[model samples]
Target: MRSCIPNVLLVSLLSTSAVICSPAPSAPPSKGTTIPLTRRSVHKRSAAEWDEWAVRHREYVTKKYNGQVKSKRASGMNLLTDQDADSDYYGSVAIGTPAVSYNVILDTGSSDLWLASSSCSGCASSSGGGPTSAASNSIPLFDPASSSTFKNLTTPFAIQYASGQATGTLGQDTVQVAGFQVSDQTFGVCDTANGVLSSPLSGLMGLAWQSLASSKATPVWQTLAASGQWDSGVMGFFLTRFGNDSHAKELEPGGQFSMGYVNDSLYTGSIDYQNVPSDQVAYWTLPVTSLTVQGKSISLPTSGSNQYAAIDTGTTLIGGPSDLVQSLYSNIDGAQAGTGSWEGYWFYPCSTSVSSSISFGGPSWSISPDDFEHTQVDSSGTQCVGAFFEVNTGDNTPGWIVGDAFLKNVYTAFRYSPPSVGFASLSSTALGENGVDGIAPSATIGSPAAVVSSTGKASSNKNDATRSRGFSVQILALVWGAAGGLLLA
Candidate 1:
C-alpha cells in the first residue's frame, strides 16, 4: 500500500512474441491486457522506526477486522504522525469525467479504492494537521467539484491505520484503468488523510474481492470481470527488484501487471495452481503445505489457522505465525532474536546463505538468499535483519502473509473464475539478481558470495537484467474535456 506511480492508465494488447500498439485497429481484443508499474524507493529511516511501524501496522490491521473498530472513525483519533515509508511499486489510474489521473498503490491485501480530496483538512494547502514531509506536499489531491459527474453519497468513510487515517465521504464517478472504464464506480473521496499520500501517489487501488472492501463496493477488477471485458478472469504479476542495485533510480520500471491472461515469456515451464480454500476465498489465500530451510523441512502448525497464507503484493515483508517463524530461524546457525524495539524480529550473520523454500501443495519454490537477508542490523557489518517477520493474526485470519520477499522469486497469477493462485519459475531473461531459478541448494553458514556490504546492499557483481518491455493496445483513446465530451484517438 506504500508504493508510488503516476495516473495515466496504459492499456496494452499482449501476444506471444512482442508488444505493440496501434490506434483503432480492427483486430479483436487480445486475451489479456497489461499496465506498467513504477517502483519508488522509500526515504531512509532508522531501524527502530521500521520496527515500531511494523508493530503498529499489525495492530491496525488486526483491529480493523476484529470488529473492535467500526469502518468509520470509532476512536476520535486525529490523523497525524509520519508512518515509516516502505518501498512501493504502484501505477496510474484516471477517475472522473475529465479523465484526471492519480498515482495509486495496487494492493491485494485489502480492498478499497480511495483518493485524497482537494479539500483535505490535513493537506498542506488546508488547515495544518497532517504529515509535513516534503513528499506529502507534492501529492495531487482529487477535487470532486471539478468533475461534472461526481456524486456524493453522503455516506461516512473512514479507515484508521497505525500512524495515520483517512476520513471522508463516499462518492460515485467513472473510474478508468487499462483502457476500461467503470461508470458510477463507488469510491471514497477523503476530506482528510494523514500519512498516506506520498509524492507521485495520491491513493490506493485494492485488487482483492468485495468481501474485504470496507466501502462495500465491488472492486474495480471484479467489476470488469463481471462485465465480460476480459477473455479470462485472471490477473498476473511479475514484480521486479531494484533495491539491491547501487545505481537504482528513484522511479525505476518495477514490472508488469497483466489482466485476463499470463505472459508466457515472463515465466518458465508450467504454472502450479493452488485452489483457494472455500473458507479463505476473500483474499488470495492458499494452504502452505510445507516450509524448508537448508533443504530440511521444518515442523509447521498442524491444526488451526497457521497453515493458511495470503499472497499479498501490498506487503513488503514475509510474515508467519510466531511459532513457525521461530522454527524457521532456528535452523540457521548464528541467527538470533531481536530485542527491544526489534522484538518479534530476527537477525543472522550477513554472510550466511539462508536458502529457503515454501510449498503450497505444489513444487517447492525457493527464496533467494538476497531476499532472506534484509538490512544490516549491526554497525560492525555482521548482523543483518531477516526478511521473515512474526505475525500473530490470531485464529480467525490467515496465519501467513506471503509478501514481496517470497513473491519476487516467482511469477504469480490470480485467477478469479475458480479462485486459485498459481506460481511459476521466472524465465532466464526474466530472472534478475534475486529471482529464483529452481530449488535452491542447501544453505551454507558462511558463504562469501552471499556477503553484503556494511550498508546491506547486494553485491555489485549480481547481474541487473534489462527491465521487461512495456505493453500497449490498439483502441480508440478516450480524450475528455471540461465540456463533457470525448475525442477518439
Candidate 2:
C-alpha cells in the first residue's frame, strides 16, 4: 500500500551498506578543465575532518564540491554472460567478462534505475579537469552497437540536482538487479551532460541510505520496480563507512555496491511509501510535526501546506523550507554560521555551540542525537569540512530534497506500487517483512529518521520513449495528431 502518514507517529527506524562486482579494467583518467575553489577565509581540508564539519555546517562541502556533484543510478540489461569488453563498473555478459558486475551510484533519494551509454560522448563535456582515467576506460561504452536488446525510446531524460544535472537518453534495455535479470527495463544513456566526475562513477545504482531523489527515477529502488525484478516491493540499503581499524579506513578501490541489507543490523518499523504525483512533475509531501531548535520547538510555515519533499540518494545533503532548516540549525550550536558560511546559501552560526540531536516529525518518530551530528572534515588544517547538502528548489518552488544527510541514520523501506503507495523498515529493522537486521551505527557512519509513508502503486511507462529530455510535452501532441490521422483515414 502506497501510504503517507502525517502526524501519525509510526515506530522509529534504523539503517544498514557495501559494493560488489568483478575486477575493474585499468582505465585511468584524462585530465580536463577544473574550477579552483580558493577561499582565503576557509581553507580546504581532508575527508576525515570533513566528516566532522558535515554535522556542524552542512552547506560547506556541498558548496565546496558544487562543481563536482553529479547524479547516477544502477543500470544494466539482459543477464547474458559473454566476452564483452566492459569494466567492473560497466559490466557485460560475455565469456571474457566472467560474471555480473555493475557500476552504480549510492544514492539516498528517489528510487530509480538507469545507465550511461558506452558510446557516451557526453563525458567529453568535462572542462579539461575531467575524470581520473582507469583501465576500464577502454571498455566499450554502453554501446547499442553491441546489444540487440537496446531499443530507442526516443526519450530525453534529465535529473536536475542542486549541483548539476545527469542528462541522457531513456531507452528500454534488458536489466539485471539483485541476481535477477529482466528482459526489458527502462534505462538511461547519458548522451549529453554537464557537471560530475570526481571519480569513474557513471550510472547510479541507488538503494540509498534516504528517500526521494534529485531526479525523475528517484533511486534504484524505483527503477527495479519498473523493471519487473522486485517490482512487487520497494528495496532497502545499509551504508557502512567505518573500518575495523583506523588504518583500514581507506576507500576500497572501485568499491562494492548493493541494493538490500548486507549485515545483521536491525530496523525499527515499516516503510512510508508516499505516492508522488504521476504527472512526472510530482514530489513527496509529508507533514512537519515540529522543528525543534536547541531542544526547543520552532515554528515553520509548512503547516497545512502540502509540503513537497524530494527523496534524493544522489545528494549528500538535505534542503527545503527555510523554517525546517532554521529550526534544525538553531537546535545545534555550531550548525549555522554567517551568510559567508554557505556562501549565503544557509549555514549554522559559527558561534553556535553544537548540540547532540535535533528532533522533528510528530512525537511518533523522533530523530536521535548522533545521527544529527555526523560530519567529515577537510584536508586543510582549518575548520573547512565535508558537508553534503540541504537546499531549496527556490521560492515557492514546490519541492524540497531530503537527502542522505537524513537517511544515513535510519532504516527505510519503500512498499512497491500496488495495493498502496509506500514501503517499510524498522528503526531496528527487526519488525519489517524482511527478517534482515538494521544498521548498527559505529564510529564510521551516520544515523536515521525516514521518509514517512506506507505504500505506492504507479503505472509503468515502458513505452515512454517520447518522455525523454529536451522533448518537452510536445510528443504528446504528436501522439494525438497521429491518432487523429488514423481516425481520418
Candidate 3:
C-alpha cells in the first residue's frame, strides 16, 4: 500500500503536522530503561528515513538572536521578532509511535526543546480525497489520559513571525530525542490556531537558549546532554538551501533535517562575535559592516539604523524596509517590480537574470541567477516570473528582517554559551551532505528563484498530511505490559 511516511520504520508515529498540533502521555519502558535514538551524527540515515527526521523536528526551531529592542537602538537592521515573545520560534519535542525525537527548526540562531501535545486540534481533512493507504493509516497518536507523567504547565503560550503567528497550550511531558530523554519536559502546542503560517510547517520546537524554553528545571539542550544522550551539549546543523548548487542537490539524499554536525566543516578561520547588549538581553544585535546593492556598495542612513541585524533561522526570505530594499534590487540586473502580498514579496522578469548576490559580514559571495526566477502567464498568454521580494507599501519599519534567503551564502554559526553568533561558508562537498532532505525530500526547488515562487507555496500545502507519531511509547508500553498485571489484580 502507498504510504506518506515510507521508511519511518522505527514504529507507529501519530501527528500530521501541517500547520499546528501537539499531544501528551507517559508509559513505562519495556525494559524499564530508555533506549537511546540511533541517530546522533550526520548522513547516517538513508534518504527516506532522513525525510522522517525532518517531519519530526518541526517543533524545535529557534531564533539565533532574541530579545527586547529599545527604539533608540532600533536601527535599520531588521531584527527577529514575534508579536508574542514566547512562541516566536517553530520547534518541538514529540513522542511518536516508533520513538521520541527532537523536531526543531534548522535555524542559525539558538537551539532548545519544546514538545508537541496530545490535545492538538488539526485542520479538517478532505473528505473527497482518496482513502488513506494501508501504510498511511498506521500512523500513531499520543494519548495522555492513561499516562501519569503528563502535566499541564503554567507558561503562557504564543508565537509571532513576520510571516504569521501560532497560539496554543503549554505543558510538560516525557520526551526522548537525538539520544536524550527527560521526564516532565515542557513544550508548547497550538491545537486550533489561526494566523499567517508557512504551509510546510505544522508545529515549532525551540532550540536556542533557555530563555526560549518553557521547561523550568533544565534547558532542552542541556537536559539532553545531562541524560548522556548527546556526545556533548553541542548541537550541529548544515542548512541545505544556503550552499552551492551541486552540494544542495546531494542534500536531498541527506534529508533536510538531521542531528549533529557535518564532519571537518570549514570556516572563515576568524570567529567574530558580539555579545548581546544587556538592554537587548534576548537577541544578539550585530553591527553592519556596510550595505551593498549588487556588486556596488551603497550609502545607508548609517549611525542610527545599523545597530542590530536579527539573525533568524526561521524565515525563508530576507526582509528590510522598502527604502533599503529598493536600492538593493535596483542593482540586480533584470530585476523589476510586481504586485505585493503577504503570500510573498514579488519581483518582475521572465527569463530570470540571476547569479547576482547581496554580500554581508566580509565576503563577496555570488547570488544564483536561477535562484530568483519564476514563470507566470501574463495577459498575453505568456509566462512571467522573477525575483522574490514584494515591497510592503503598508509598512516601512515593519520589521525589515533578513531571512534564510540572504544567510544561505554564509557559513552561519550560533554560539549559545556566550549568547553570540558566528558566520562562514562550507566547501562544495560539505554542502551536498547537509540540505534539501532535511526540509522536504519531495520538493524540487532550485535555489532561491524556485523557492520564491507561488509554486513553492503550493508544495508546502502538502505538509498538512504529514503524520504525528501514532502512539505514545510510554503509554502503550505500560498498558500492553500491564495486561498480565491486570489479571493478577
Please, what are the lDDT tens digits per residue for candidate 3 over residues 56-79? 221111221222132211211121
Best by TM-score: 1
Give, for candidate 2, the lowest lDDT window spanning 10 residues. Answer: 471-480
* Residue 273 lDDT (model 3): 45
How far out, in Å, is residue 400 in model 2?
Answer: 4.0
Residue 139 CA displacement from its true place in model 2, Å: 7.6
lDDT of 1 by residue, 229-327 (tens): 455667777776654554443344556666556778789999889998876767788988999997778887656677888787766667787888898
TM-score, structure 3 vs. true: 0.56
TM-score of 2: 0.53
**Backbone clashes in each candidate structure, one number apiece?**
3, 180, 91
Task: Report, for every candidate in turn, its global Cα lDDT versus the true structure.
Answer: 0.58, 0.31, 0.32
Per-residue alpha-carbon lDDT of candidate 2 for residues 322-355, written as tens digits (9 for 90 to 100): 5455555555545544343333233343323343
Worst 10 residues of 1 by lDDT: 442-451
